[model samples]
Target: MEPSKSEDIYKETKTAKVDDSHEFNEAEVKRLSNYLSTRVIEIVVGVSHKRTFYIHEGLLCYASEKFKIQLRGYFKEAQTGKIPDCQEDPELFAVFADFLYHDGWLRKRKSLYYSCEWVMVSRCYAMGERLGSKVFQRECLWKLQHSITLKKFTIANDALCRILKATTELPERTTGNEDPLRALVLRYAAGQISTLRKDPAFKELLDEHPELGCQILMRVTDDESDCQPSGAPPEKRFEDKVEFL
Candidate 1:
């Protein structure tokens, strides 16, 4: 059988070592190639001004169970070969497509701009949750955590507010278990509460999402017993408690 375009690209990527950190081993290349198919599905992102992405049906289904179900027999998407009117941000959906095809290319591209990285990852996590792709969600969360702990990337208040609102709106938020993304955000917020509280915009955000305020307060109170001396950074005191879900 002839190798598909995705397989050819993966082979080239492996040969070139496009991203050393996420180089696809031979076995991984073969595994990824297994999902290649000629059929393409058009996904329309955004509401008023839509952006479309043409994705391989097999790979799309393989990456997202939600897409698999939505594109199965008898569904409108199956009949039309299109998922129309998806509400995810077009740029964010582009990131999802990059993950489906090129793996770490998005990370390599976004690394240059540290300011927007957390917001991008957080939005990607929310999208992953919506698409029911645990692997994608895990990858995004790992990136977010890595940026926070190792790179010392601090999320801006406006970005945090956007992330918190996006995460809180997810259907999974009501599932009773503490969401890892939410926990991560709350932990970060708690650590930086002193500075965040001083921001008028953050104050308005708390009013808009009262639960966030409550959660931040609880996180701070709960960690007080384990806090280091006043000289220690708040993030250092709470950092150890973060658990990736």
Candidate 2:
């Protein structure tokens, strides 16, 4: 027996109900976005140029582990409902705020140059590392990997110095758990070896932080033998390899 025309029409009209749990619903997204943008809490960041940011507690706490614990835990700030003297750079935090709300900073600026943006991103990664925000840290890595392209390597002297300084200072623990940012910087510097070598600031950076030179060498040469300092012990080889690179 054939199915009725009425039954076929009913089946056609009964479209599959979407699983909005994973999908973005415009109305719901708009409502939540508005809430996040309302700015209920004040965060004071920076030293010389102290900047106070008005942000939503929910959005902030959700994105940052430091804020989540500080705002919600049994702390004085929790009772007072005020985040004071955060000691973060306002400029860096601004980029972080963009990430928290929009999941990225790319949408905010259309004509922003990579040199300018990567500096901000490097700072954000530093902030994330300090705050123990794995989410923000991961996002920073993703953004850098996706956005950074091989060009003439036009980062400002100050920014390049800062990046070099930041990468060198990261502490080493047990095996592979080093600061990932350090590796990213090494790769970047390797790609721009020619330009970076000519820069006086970069030379000064190497003089100040000699380990960065090793990192550059390690990244430039793919083979361990090429980077290996003479007579380095077998056991210490991997440790030294990661130490520089």
Write candidate 1's Cα lDDT for 1-245 as tens digits. 24434234323333331112323345443354544543789998876678999998866765676676666544567778998766777888888897886556433323323546667778888878767677677667656654555434567777777777766754545668777777777777788888889988888877877777887888885543222122212111011233359
* Candidate 2 lDDT score at position 5: 41
* Root-mean-square deviation of every model: 13.7, 20.4
Alpha carbon lDDT at 61, candidate 1:
64
Question: What is the lDDT for 49 in model 2?
Answer: 86
Compared with the true structure, what per-residue lDDT tens digits does model 2 show for residues 115-225?
667777777777776565667776666555544432334666567777777665344556976566777677767767877888888899888888788878778855322
Clashing pairs in 1: none
All candidates' TM-scores? 0.72, 0.66
Which TM-score value belongs to model 2?
0.66
What's the distance in Å from true for residue 215, model 2? 1.7
Count clashing residue pairs in model 1: 0
